[model samples]
Target: MPPAHPFDFGAIDDDEGDTLHEECGVFGVIGVTDAANFVALGLHALQHRGQEAGGIVTHAPDVGFQSVRRFGYVRDNFTDPETMAMLPGQLGIGHVRYSTAGSKGQTAIRDVQPFFGEFAMGGAAIAHNGNITNANALRRELIERGSIFQSSSDSECIIHLMARSLQKTIPDRMEDALRRVEGAFSIVAMTRTKLIGVRDPLGVRPLVLGRIGDGWALSSETCALDIIGAEFIREIEPGEMIVITDKGIESTYPFRPKRPRFCIFEHVYFSRPDSILGGRSVYETREAIGRELAKEAPVEADLVCPVPDSGTPAAIGFSLESGIPYAMGIIRNQYMGRTFIEPTEQIRNMGVRLKLNVNRALIRGKRVILVDDSVVRGTTSRKIKEMILDAGAREVHFRIASPPTAWPCFYGVDTPQREKLLAATMSEEEMRDHLQVDSLRFISLDGLYRAVGESRGRDASAPQYCDACFSGEYPVEPADMVEQGFRPKTAAE
Candidate 1:
């Protein structure tokens, strides 16, 4: 059978189904020839990091700073001839946001960031990715100190800290404030004359600095650098602050040093295959996972095929190691949009099917090895398996690129509670039975860490990767699950 076409049917909203719980993506550029254009281009690459809304804050010599933000995709909101004409500046910062803190309320334009603020010292605007676990605690402290907040996001807490600090420089003020905050974060703040970037001490999120001629760019992923024509320098050290100004890029470390815990999920799921994070290539890392999986759990199959997109690289690695021919067994619908569908359970299910379809020509009567990045709820994987069977695949052998997720994530990614994870409740054999696959395998935790060219011991890269989702070892536990509204339902209670 021929490969299925990837066009969206418009039958369901493009934004339907399971999502990567990304907090946001941040971009900033200074000393660039066309700073606005570079920011637009950078935001476009980081669009996958967010989709709720997008905005840019540009500095104007006469007017100070001006911004244009709209609640929509980057391509949908900015960069037209008219919008581009309005955004004028040589130094600018941009953001694409997903609702972690403010998703419950209105998708208000005000909640969207590059959150512009006016202070006695100077005005500043910030774009942030990651959640502050202690935001409520911090908010109460600020309120007691007589500080007023404009946004509900924990990100607002930082600005309040900045306002209260007596430090002479913006970096010092940020460093002073960051010292008091906890949880995962990568922040981009724009002042009248400087662009300030800060990452949490643990480095639970990603941040990188790139350079092109005299221009300096900071972004959440190296893919953005590739888009904006910036050379990938190196990751901003796990607990470092970088201040970009006309004087050039200055680096600082105000927080006490801690092991870098760059989120491993970036390589497993979040980052683009072309990106390089924490000094390792994402594409190569994923492939290594496949190779490691084949070594760890060899399966008898006629051909190896990935789930498409995220699963392809690992599938290739699996094929190389297992010596099976790799094939494109599934085709994803390209036309899906988040606002394309109305919110209803039935509608959402239909949306998932429209997003993915099996290629009958490729799988009929063949023993197939199915590859995927991770199995979250197992619903998506189950559906894809059923589709492959419907396409006449004789047997579906399932292999995952990373270890089974057994815990919830607090730093950023919105993984379901522990009970929702298939592996957490069931053994591998049980999971195979539930999904009705011929066999099942997942990469080991140690192997996954090594696949990225680092071991899990001393001298490991991304030492602070919040692996709680896969290992049940959280960096910091919530005060109480019930207080956070994540308590599980008892079988009888």
Candidate 2:
């Protein structure tokens, strides 16, 4: 055979330096009729987790396995009759992605996942939801050994590792592959007759199991289970792997157990309000954050208003706790997606106007309190405050649901560099003046843990959740980034 061509990793633009981004979402189903349809619905519900592209891989008798990958929303691609017609099977897996580890232009479609590989044993399709910090280092080693690659995504590293494994069974090979990997991961994979799910030892990301009649489903959140009329069973524990076959589901612990470090930001912004995370309703958790903020930083304002959608739940809690009337002072455009994901600052600035508008009639001459999840660059918050003031508000006070984001997250979240973060360089008073509001306050770090059901507050020596962005204490060292001379901001800084 001729020499295999190497995959081009340099084509990817790794410098996404403006906003925080969730990695991706994965869903899988087995022992269900029309499994592709259910997987589509699950991916639809998870579209919030990732919006750039989506794909579904399915296995069936006689027809073998088929896939449909598209470069837009799930509803736009997977819901089409023509597209669904191409995918028919009883076992399926899917992914919705926002490209934390791949390029950002048209070539990005190559990275759209549910990545499939044909090994000597059979075919395995895998969809991953987190980042591998050592992917570049591993990719270099693989290429030096004459291993050609297909996609630019860090996820492809798993396939290459599995291919090189000497293990006989696919699950054995998978475990062997994961043992050599580092960083956060929640993976859903499928063989010819079985579906598999696994979470990293740290449990930095989320993956849950559900039951749909006689079938079993694995999803990134409980909301996906609700979308497909599935009963919530339980979360796939960290270091645990479940293989769902015709016989039943078999559980195995592949890695050594460690303390769980679930992402705290999930409750703040990533998860849907309707979802359940860490055995608590995400909506209730966010509301509790608002109430805690009210206790820590009370403001005597006439009206409380939210940035809309993500901030609505928290704002309601703030109003109830502070006895201020909640009003829809800012109306968001239902058609607009999130602005922070936009690649350029100019587009992000334009997106604010297209995405939200001020209710001039309600804000004129009234003291308004603006409730938002978190501020990164202070661009949107500053713009919103200006808009409120131009609408004749007597005073504009800003209340944030989470503590200041001073450090960059290297596990999976696409946070800007520490130097680019507004809080990394400015004092609280400086940030207040920078946004140009009457007053500005963020929830204290301990206040956030209290809202999340930690009554004793955050333990400095042993944190309950991954609050690295707020606290600057990373559970997992970003080895690859550290080698690249990327120094994280210390808490003392």
Winning model by lDDT: 2
Per-residue lDDT over 149-168 for candidate 1, one digit per residue giving the tens place of the 0 to 100 score? 76656677888888889988
Over 4 Å off in model 2, which ranges?
1-19, 337-349, 455-463, 489-493
Candidate with top TM-score is 2
Please give the CA lDDT of all the candidate structures: 0.78, 0.85
* TM-score, cand. 2: 0.93
